[model samples]
Target: MRAVIATEPGGPEVLTVTEIADPEIGPGEVLLDVAAAGLNRADLLQRQGFYPPPPGASDVIGMECSGTVAAVGPDVTGWSVGDQACALLAGGGYAERVAVPAGQLMPVPDGVDLVTAAAIPEVAATVWSNVFMVAGLQPQETLLVHGGAGGIGSFAIQLAHQLGSRVVTTAGSADKLAACTALGADVAINYRDQDFVEVVAEQTDGGVDVILDNMGAKYLDRNIDALRTQGRLVIIGMQGGTKAELDINKLLRKRGAVIATNLRGRPVEEKSAICASVVQHVWPLVAEGLVQPIVGRSFPLAEAGAAHAYMESGDHSGKILLTV
Candidate 1:
């Protein structure tokens, strides 16, 4: 099998394609002839030695993939060979083939191509588990999402809009904000030109009811200032620096909650639960054409380095994909 291995991570130049032994399937696992894999910011971080795969996970950088089942492990049932499926991976997606636990896989929606299906799993699972499952965003409430044109943010905007929430989003450029508005965001602010705190407060009259933040320390204070009373703040990634300062009085006055979460490190049972929820609930929206995965661009497997460079440039919108 051909695989992209990070030979002593430092930069995109570290990714090397080499022939390696195929990953063996374990009980309850399925072997996939990967059609495509999604490139995430986390993959860049991992390649630079900032993030490592969680304990017992594959060291390869990929986090999600879509393909056909080549074979099923002995203990697997219900899913036979040749099913069109997408899966959330802890690692090992940057390869010709990957072995995925059956519990982590979902059948691709009808009419969706394999490449686009690769773009859906991570963004779907991330936004659904965080903004919906953990934060409990309600219909008619105001929701504010940061990085509105990025992978997870774009998905969050659509889901919140479809669920009847008034959505607000902050991005660095007017063009990005315009894209967010087209995706049903009620209020879109250019973060580089204005402070989102004032823009959100003016729109919602105080602040929004929910906030999805990826900027950790840099936005910590401002995020609190932009939340309405009893609002929920969900943190899924830390693009900004780590250490942060908080104003305890602000929480006391608002009676709100601040929650930090990560989906990749979760136990198998929890991931399986999220997969089931997506199959039952989110899949219907996909099948009905109410939602679709946004795949921004694609590079072949050998060009994983270029994919990383593109993502780091911050010039692309939606999800970046690597065709295997």
Candidate 2:
């Protein structure tokens, strides 16, 4: 097997592809010959030595992939050799082969190709679990999304729109905002020159009902200010920095709740449940073409360093993929 390894975490230049031992499956696991893998911001963090894989996880730098089942491990059922599947991996999707728990394997949606399917699991699960399941965004509610041109934000905009919620999103430029609007955002604000909090408040007649945030502490105070009474704010990224003061008084006055979550470190049982929910709810939307993979660009597996560079440059929208 060949996988990407960070040769002393620092920059994209630190990443290199090298021969590695093949993975073996355990009970209830499946062995996959990876077709493609998705690139995410977390991958950049891992390369910089800010994030490390969970104990016993593959040190390889990918979190989701599409592949064909090569073999199923002991006690696995309902999947067979040659089945087309996409998996939410703890790590190791950057390799040619990976061992995934059967519970994390989802059949490729009817309308999607195998390579594109690699872009779905991580963003879909993150959006569905955070906005729908955890935040409890309801139809007719207004949802605010930060970084709307990126993978999770693009998916969140579409899914919220399709589910009957009014969507408001902020991006860095007019072109990015336009792209967000094309994906069904009801209101797109250019964060570089606009006040998203005010825009969301005016558009929603006070504030938004749910906010999917990636900027973390940099936007915390303003995020709380943008929320309506009883609103939910789910923070999934920390690109902005980790430490910030919270106004407990303001949160209490609005009766709002804050949640911080990460998909990578969760237990297998919890991940399995989230995967099942996505297969049930999100897969149908995708199969019907109501939602689709938003692949911004792809790189051959060997050029993963370039892929990381592109993503870090913030010059691309949606998911970047590595073709295995």
Candidate 3:
């Protein structure tokens, strides 16, 4: 099998694809002949030596992929050889073959192609678990998503909008803002010029009911200010830095709740539950064409390094993929 690994903890230049032994499946796992893999911000962090895979996980740097099942291990059922599925993984997605816990597999939605299905798992699981399950976003409520042009944000915008939540999002450029609006954002703020806190306030009656934030500490203070009474703020990434002061008095006044979560380090049972929920709740929207996989571009699997460089350039929208 050919797999991608960082030669050293450094930049995109450190990534290299080389021959590696095919992974062996464990009980309750399935071996997939991967068709494509999804590139994520966390992959970049891992390449740069910041984020390591969870204990006992494969060191390869990908988090999600779409593929056909080549074999199933003992104790696994409901899946068989030749089944087409997309999966959530802790690691090893950047390879020709990956062994996945059967519980992490999801059927490809009715209208998505194999390569495109590679782009859906991570973003869908992240957005669905965080925005709907964790924060409990409801119909008629308002939601705000940061980095609206990126994978998670883009899916969040569409899902929230389709589910009847008024969506507000922030992007860096006019074209990106337009794209977000087209995806169902009621208001798209250009983060480079506008104050999102103010725009969110003006768009909603007072503040948003929920905020799906990835900018961590940089947005902490303002995120609190932008919350409606009893609002929930779910922080899933620290793109803007990790530490900041929080105004407890203000949060107390609004009775808001702040939750910080990570999807990759979860136990298999938990991941399985999230995958099940997404298949049940989100896949139908995709099947109905109410939500779609948004893929910006793809590179051959051997060009994983270049793919990393492109994602770091911050010029692409939606998900980037590596086709096997």
lDDT of each: 0.90, 0.95, 0.96
Rank ordering of all candidates by lDDT, starting from the highest: 3, 2, 1
lDDT of 2 at 80: 97
Please estimate how well model 1 matches the true structure, expressed as its whole-model Cα lDDT: 0.90
lDDT by residue (97-187, candidate 3, tens digit) is: 9999999999999999999999999999999999999999999999999999999999999999999999999999999999999999999
TM-scores vs. true structure, each candidate: 0.98, 0.99, 0.99
Model 3 stretches with alpha carbons more than 4 Å out: none
Predicted structure 1, TM vs. truth: 0.98
lDDT of 1 by residue, 1-324 (tens): 999989996989999999889889989899998999999888988999988998988888899999999999989987988899999999999998999989999999877888889999999999888888889888999999999999988988998998899999988887888889998899999988899999987888779988999988889899999999999998877888788989999987999899998888898889989988988878888887777787789999999999999999999889999998
lDDT of 2 by residue, 214-290 (tens): 99999999999999999999999999999899999999999999999999999999999999999999999999999
- Number of clashes found in candidate 3: 0
lDDT of 1 at 265: 87
